[model samples]
Target: MTDLRHRLDAFVKLGDFFKEYCKYAKNQTQIDDNQHAWLKKFDEILALAGHKNGWFTPENILFSLESWAELLTPSKLESWLMAYEVDKNKPKSVALIMAGNIPLVGFHDFLSTLITGNRAIVKLSSNDQVLLPFVAQYLIEMEPSFKDKISFADGKLEDFDAVIATGSDNTSRYFEHYFGKKPNIIRKNRNSAAVLSGNETKEELTALGEDIFRYYGLGCRSVSKLFVPKDFNFDALFKAVYPYNTIIEHHKYANNYDYNKAVYLMSLFKILENGFLMLKEDNNYASPIATVFYEFYDSMEDLKIRLSQEQDKIQCIVSKGFIADEIPFGQTQKPSLNDYADNIDTVDFLLKT
Candidate 1:
């Protein structure tokens, strides 16, 4: 088989292995001593990731892994790559500065670099230090050819042709200053929002709760704000999202809920609370943890115009037939392989570089 095909096969094998670890219980027989050892290590990592970083809850990490497992199928990978003419000649080194806000957030960029036959020099965020390296080892074990192509940076990132960095608005300035000279994709803070027309069913709104509560609303794809009609009643929304009230049981999330609610109350801000989540009437997209900002919209056309004007500040728009590019209620976090972050085609960028 050709080298590219071999690499794709290795990723498929990694996906299959990941499926076995998606659950708390083991269902598959051991493949080999090395595989068994890796599975044991994976179990330990899954158990300790939350202890290492409270944000990296086992459910969220496994959700990420399961999403990747579903996306890494041979057919899906082939379809995602079919649009681009991958150039294997003279592979360039691509530096990746990953964000630690969510689990395995940088895997897509790393996958793009390697799938396009480029060397990947990853600078991992301290918050997400463990999982990717473990996956990298699995990949190398599956295909020895990748051994020389992937490297992690300890300090300065040097001798790279292009860069991809994900950070907050503040750190983006630093990325631009340092990596600006090179070809790069520097992503800053962006949040997702949901649009409600007051006609959504209880099931849809409940699913929308998954979009809001998943990852503790820490991921850029998590819905931090809502756009509802002026006459929209939030009673149904409150009822539908009640199932996720259990999220407040998490200590870190509960702390944020208590703290933000107290601050809003002290400021006398008119906010709606359902014990676990606070809904404040604000125009901002980036809301604090355990809080969701909401805005009232007058006209669909005007709202569309506003969203278009603020496209740079937004990520995914969760809606049901409200907008053309609206992501379904709960699928923001389950993006397909081609659902490139920031709507910038990472594969196309890599192919050009």
Candidate 2:
């Protein structure tokens, strides 16, 4: 195998470790001191992650780990990379400005940089500082060659040939000004939406709750908006999604729910609520926490055109047969390695850079 193949094998091993650690974590089992040092370190990192960010609940962290574990298998890695010509030329330094909205949100970019034979200079978000570095350490231990290729930046990012930065719409402007001259992928705020045809089964609608409530709807893949047919009965939707009402128990989420509900009521905006999530008639894509903006569509063709026109602001579209690229309900958060954020192919860009 070539050096790149060796690196891919090391990542597959790291994925196996993540799977084992997640199993133990979910069971709350104590790791033996004599167990692999990496396992103990993984335990420490999981604890630190929860302590650093309240939203990084143990369940959510494990969910993220499980998703990655499923995606990083050797066969999956090979399939994802099969289309690209991973050259072993002089590797460029790729700087990554990661997001912390979801656990390991920027991992795809990190993996792309290394798998494509480039150095990664990662600047982690304060909200997500613990997990990726530990994964990097595991990769290094599995294949020492990665030690020189992986780095974490504490200060201004310099000495990089290309950059991949993800942030809110405001920060994207700053990134454009700073890194505009360099070959870069600067991503702004984007949100996902779901389309309801009024014929969805209760089970399917309930599954859609996962797309909305996962990570408390902080991830770009989380469904923040809904497009339902005219005369759609929201009672069924609310009843189906009632299982996720437990999200209100989280203080942060409760606070947002109360605040946003109060604002909408004071503004005299007609809204529907099931005591947990509020749904309002709006056309916007990015909804506030605990609230999902929704719109009524009269024609599927027109809706498709509008969605296509506004594709830049959309991430994943949750539907059964509405569009060719529609993601199945409840599967938005479980994106494969090839599901590049914003539909911009990171591996292809890295290979060319």
Candidate 3:
């Protein structure tokens, strides 16, 4: 299991499993006898996942599967690791403290530690307890050697050489207090926002709705805020994103919408709404569910400077021609392998450890 090729092959096979399962689940393909049983297994798993967490909708879970399947190819994995010197590494136990804001939110860290020939001591969030354990089981089934390489922590985490922990700004302090002395990557709350010039096309605006509404705006990559020019009209934007009005049909989403709207109204906040989504003018980067906070900018130059100053508080700035690393309006959630969380190079850190 120390050899990189064996671990890499295991991940590729796992990716194939995900790709085939997705196709079969969608009625786009057929499964053979050996793999037929997995169909029901994954179906039940998705159902259980949704039951455990209301926000883990089947579509969002499937999207996560599809995205990982697309990225785990031989060429993509090789290309990503190609930039780093991965061979000369002493194996160490790495502790992974994951967040459950989105489904499979911590898979990258799990994947990184195991793929680099290190033992993983995982501590999964209660909100996402099932998915990754099943994933690890599948990988171990594909390559039995991985069984000894990964273990889940049910109580306090100990006997790990390093750690990668993700949480909110508050929980991050708790993490630092406990695991502060270890070689670690501790991530805090960071949000994404979009910059608009009021001239976006209909299709672009429609796509931006995906960025806003997907995962119920829970992921760090979800667009929770917007920077728009003064006097920006909302008529065109609302008309374009009207197709996603059905998002309000989900009971949990509808509850959030009703709750946040009532809170805003009672507080005498001036907000704009199109029945499903709300728009409020706020200076903050993080917005509550069902609402997107927007701020007016006087000039592009000044806005760029402001975003630069707050870059640490921002994750991905979804825009066109605004910043060097600006993610496209709708592609924030669909990040590639190189899009490290908090912009920290996990692979490089693990390789050295």
Candidate 4:
């Protein structure tokens, strides 16, 4: 058998091992009883993974896994391999620079390296250093061999065959200077948005709220902006999000909301027209503390034109107002296996090794 093929086989076995480990960790993390119980539901796992707020249920977990598998399947990996004419299961060290916006956001990078038969040096985020080791330990339990391939660096970053780094636009400059010399994927800040025809059902709008409010709107994938019809009813949108009003009650979120609101009011009072500024429009697409900031457009055509003009600035757009056969609203942050970060495939990057 080819060495690459053997490594690929080992990776498939590793996936089974890690999946079990993940399942076990879910059952045994050191959270409070309530949080643990809440995690017992698979949907709860999805909500946790995606930073949403629904109770856990089996289907949610099942669908989440199904979606993950479809994205990261062996065939998918091989397709990437075919393009490069390179061996996936070979000696290569991959340095993963993880993002901490969502729970264990850097996990996909770990899995990609493992399944592709590469050694990995993980640089965990300071904001979320606690959870990754617990996950890595479980993988070790599944297969003792994995212990050698994975290393969580608490100190300096070591050299690797390739690199994958994620951060804001500002930090990207540092990443580019440090790792740009090598083959790398350094992601910049990209804000997600949603298009509202104002015709969305209550359930869909509530789910959208989950997308916006989860993680307190810290993720790049979080919906930071919305495009709505000029005559869209703001009251209905606010009412739909009323259940999440408790988020506004939190001191941190309330402080941010109040601060931004005050600044906005002052700016309007000084020069801009109050009506045109759209106070209480909620916060912009970066982080929605409690409410949204909205700008009305006369029609979908106008909104589309504006969105097209600003496509460079906007990331993903969620919409239920007009069906475009493209699933827009729900696809934010919840990345498919094929949805490589920074719009570049990591396995493809590794092929150079």
Give the range where candidate 4 is weakest over 10 consecutive residues by summed lDDT.
Answer: 270-279
Cα lDDT, all candidates:
0.91, 0.92, 0.92, 0.61
Please provide the root mean square deviation of candidate 4 (C-alpha atoms, Å). 7.0
lDDT of 4 at 209: 71
Please provide, for model 3 over 232-337, each residue's C-alpha lDDT reduced to its tens digit, 9 standing for 90 to 100. Answer: 8888889989999999999999999999999999999999999999999999999999999999999999999988899889999888888888888789989999
Give the per-residue lDDT of model 1 (tens digit) for 81-101. Answer: 888878444689999999999
Q: Pick the candidate with the highest TM-score.
A: 3
Q: Which stretches of candidate 3 lie over 4 Å from their true place?
A: none
Write model 4 residue lDDT over 102-220, tens digit each, in one string: 56667777876775667889998765564556556645655566688889887878778788887888988999999988778888887777778778877777777766765566666
Pairs of residues clashing in candidate 3: none
Worst 10 residues of 2 by lDDT: 27-36
State residue 328's C-alpha deviation in candidate 2, in Å.
Answer: 0.5
lDDT of 2: 0.92
RMSD of each: 1.5, 1.5, 1.1, 7.0
Between candidates 3 and 4, the TM-score winner: 3
